[model samples]
Target: MPYDFNQQIIQEFRANRGKVGGPFEGARLLLLTTTGARSGVRRTVPLGYLNDEGGRMLVIASAGGAPHHPAWYHNLRADPRVTVETGVFTVEAEAAVLEGEERERLFARAVEADSGWADYQARSGRVLPVVALTPRSVSFPDLPEGASPPLHADRLDATLVPATSDDRAAVMAAIRSLLAGAPALGADVTPALAHTGGVPGVWVSAAGGSATGDGVTLYVHGGGFEHTQPALEPLMACRLSEATRRPAFKVEQRLAPVHPYPAALDDVVAVYRSLLEQGVPSDRVIVCGESSGGTLVLSALLALKEAGDPLPGAAVAISPLTDLTLSSRSLDVDDGRDVISRRVAEHVTAQYLAGAPADQAPQSPLHGDLSGLPPLLLVAGTAEVLLDDTRRFAAAASAAGAEVTLDLYEGMPHAFHASVMAQDPPAVAMTFLRRLADWVAGSRARGRRGC
Candidate 1:
């Protein structure tokens, strides 16, 4: 469902009626009044504020740090003349790009305002364009729905891959056996089978193993495209395994910077194919991941469809880095959240996606076709800088006619699932995993009705 945050937020330190809540509470915010590119009217958007060096408000054109620029941002670039409104007062300003030491000093200031911005920058691997809304004067243009975001082909053909009787039996046996064992502490996670043909390097989580039940979920972990392991993700993995009451098999895939790009994607494809060969039905699987892992999940889904493999029933992502372009305006705006910085994330992106084309289907799922993938659940903290990536990706997916569910936890940090050790983590994480388990179980039941 579309978030009604603009109307639902209880607190008020206002900007525009459309201004969604972010992490920086006291930081000064401004409404950029710009003219529409195609239309001849004025449009106002509330954005996060940063005072570079001598208190000059700095706004980076990091449109959720996506590779492409946002429409409003592009409008300003076309006509540098614009107006700025801080609840205090309105002033005319010129939107000029910032670079070099001036850019660095100001970016540092912006990061100080919100750390999550740093994380966005890191994930994007881009210089994160910075702009200054300096005082100026000009007539604003009328803003209309300037243009729509990019669209990739949909991968919902997996609905064609029916669950066979034998596939149902394997899944049921895995789930029952997995449910029979003691759950792994902080590591046991809900597992589901997605495809029937077993892909190489993949194993079906059977019942009565370390974690029990019929196979209910398929889990992939995130490491920023360079450094994560299934062992490291045991906390959420285990939780998800037990919650789904199935064997949750973690893909210990290769990383980037060395292995890079499709190496990880290849492993995912290989594993899914292996499952199908083993008689696991695609409809019974739920593909999932977090951060970089989230990126892999979506990318793998697209690859599967491209290879004519059946798609999974549902998927979940925690702070998934959907946009590799790092061009969203929010990267600089939502900077207060922790656990990552835009600088670090961007660096990882540059290394992992290095040499790979920006529009490559396997490198960035955001650039792939999102239509007909599957039911999707996207969870991210309101404070997270990548929140815009989640926002845009979900919007894009919805626009593409996919069922997308998004939950933005207020004040939660990036990768909140891994931060279960952090003070006051959400009870919803645990609850969500449990719900996922039930959903997988229910889906399995539906497929086995005649069996």
Candidate 2:
């Protein structure tokens, strides 16, 4: 592990797309560049890596079993920001060193993958450091060239029927009409009377047959905090059911402006609890939502954890509003490209908070303890104002040692996944849903395998 020899390997790695000959041939290697803690200079080191269950790249500070910690580890501690190069792609990532039980578990997995790590740990005597390279931004390589402009720009001239506090009935009617107008992508919708702990909801499943399993998806629909329409639930539920090959329970939780703060949170938690009470194992359940509903999905997980309830296998949030404080930088930067403006976001937040602290945990989950939550998949569009909400939440969750995957679609608007059937080229949206479904299914399978 001499400096001159390391530099030779680094040169070989760069020349060979992260591959090198001799002892490191066919090894999984990545180039980590960190700013020096003292000198503030960029330092690059080639290291081996292991992909964790959360899809994060794990790099060990073995330093070839040196007595002292690696210099790059010190740099990362001083500044978490780091650049990662794997093969031909380079990504900006935040480096987080795992600790205690989480560190032990990941280290064991690494040792299992490669026994050399155990020898490194034995020789070092020090706890071998494990660093998670959590991506800050993901690039979409498959995006079509010469694609259409942003979706919101084309619809800007369309009629704007504002949903107001005074016109609650009008808002409900408008939401129903919008849902009714959406093209049904071939899903069997059935009404469920007094489902989910006496809360009414809809059951969306595939058309061919009834979905049979303890595994179910509890879906909460998004309409800021004011609007809750049964019509909107099935559109996404059917797709979810089709994707996961399980029944989707679309919960009609109480909305804001009337049943503020804990009411909606309580109702969603009740539905989740009811599923557990009805013989559905916690690991077989997956909670999912969008927009404000996405907020609820995260909040419910926090509440469930607080109550000592068994957590679900996984959860999905699409364009979720994680911060009611409206403090994300993207809110101002991406405002014009999104459908929800600052004025609308502020009004919705006020209605939802209703005198409650805006930064309260389980209300605005961004401020909550994200440690014990289930594996999460967050999907958002680059142009959406709430894009930062998703990104920040994902980062926090990952930092807290929770499994999280964030997918950002280029040039799409807020909740654009809902526009799967409406867009001219629905390829991106379709791909997103398919990936979500695959994640859910895979998570369930992993649970069955005791991972």
Candidate 3:
């Protein structure tokens, strides 16, 4: 309705080479400069785009479901030629509207990739238009002279090499050392050993003034399931404790390529059961983790449900790896943007699964029955390779009648919340941590009131 907001976004987009702050910071946005149909003056608008099969870039003219078509859409209809800036690269493209089944199919794919499009459509009683922007020519400057760049250059980093078993101990030690002197953020750090349901683990907590009697958080760390980092998990545990004003436990589980498949899962389940047996009411405990640790938290919930065991009050999965199959579009779209890689996924899958089917329940919880699980809060960054995993899982879980809340951070990377202190202004990670704490505390309060 107003050009002022669009103008501000346009300015940020141009200044940042496609990157913009605020809600759209980490989102996939492209600046479309079009020739006005009547005015004939050039007009620019920032829109989200999806990469289609035939190397075509797809943009939805949902206009947040406005009654009339967006001005840019009308401009494109009159003049097919358009200028597109995808943050990373600028290109000349021809836009063509899709109709009938093609439009429906692509729209469905967009909804699957991001449910926000569906929400926009639902809010307005109109058929959203989909336009295909086929590039006239692709350019790549960083590639070797003879090497042709792929259809899309979304990845900003090179492919990573997977770590082997020999690197496990050293990696763990280094992470532990880095987190050894981590600031508690006003909480006191305490180290303790615990045995949950006969499974032993190292328990670290942030207590004292910040501690509350409401409940506790079980913090799981992520290292591709191959190794356990003592420092990182403890640091996260401390943050959780401080944020929630409750004690937090960092459970140490066996690593894969050594214990494999059900080993880590079993250990976490034991810890959960032990918490229940130790007089912690089921509704007072919150289970949470990042990366593979997130996967473990979800899998444990499934395992506990199947076994008729009590469930926790709520769960939080941060940039979790839900699909062992490694089949998410963001994996390709975020290849260079994320630190994790296909090699690491394959390596971790091999080590953890140890010949188990990729879609096996409890191993790949996305394939498991999500019913009966407790309320889930999933946090993921649009820039993460596992973005699709969290999105798909949240969608599936919600469809199964589970209480699921998915928070898509615009531009965060994997485990962005793991750091005790974030360098960015607004400290998005710390904000998320505090949000998690509030959610957990609220859940407990509701339960106590029998709400």
Best by TM-score: 2
| Model 3: lowest-lDDT 10 consecutive positions | 155-164
Model 3: per-residue Cα lDDT over 160-228, one tens digit each: 112223233333343344555544344455533244677655454555432124566787778988887
Ranking by lDDT: 2, 3, 1
lDDT by candidate, in order shown: 0.59, 0.73, 0.71
Off by over 4 Å in 2: 1-180, 190-194, 207-214, 421-425, 445-451
Comparing candidate 1 with candidate 3, which one achieves the higher lDDT?
3
Estimate the TM-score for candidate 2: 0.62
Writing each residue's lDDT as its tens digit, candidate 1 over 1-451 gives 0125422322243432123356635444566768888785776665666654322467876666676766677788788788775432234667888879988988887788688678878877777778887653211111111133223223111110111234333333433443344234533233344442333223334333422123335677777878863333554555565555555666777777888787887887677666656665565556778888888888888888787777876787778887788765446666644557788778888888877875667577777887777777777765567866776666667667676555555345566556332222335444445445555565457563100
How many residue pairs collide in each prediction? 103, 0, 5
| Winner of 1 and 2 under lDDT | 2
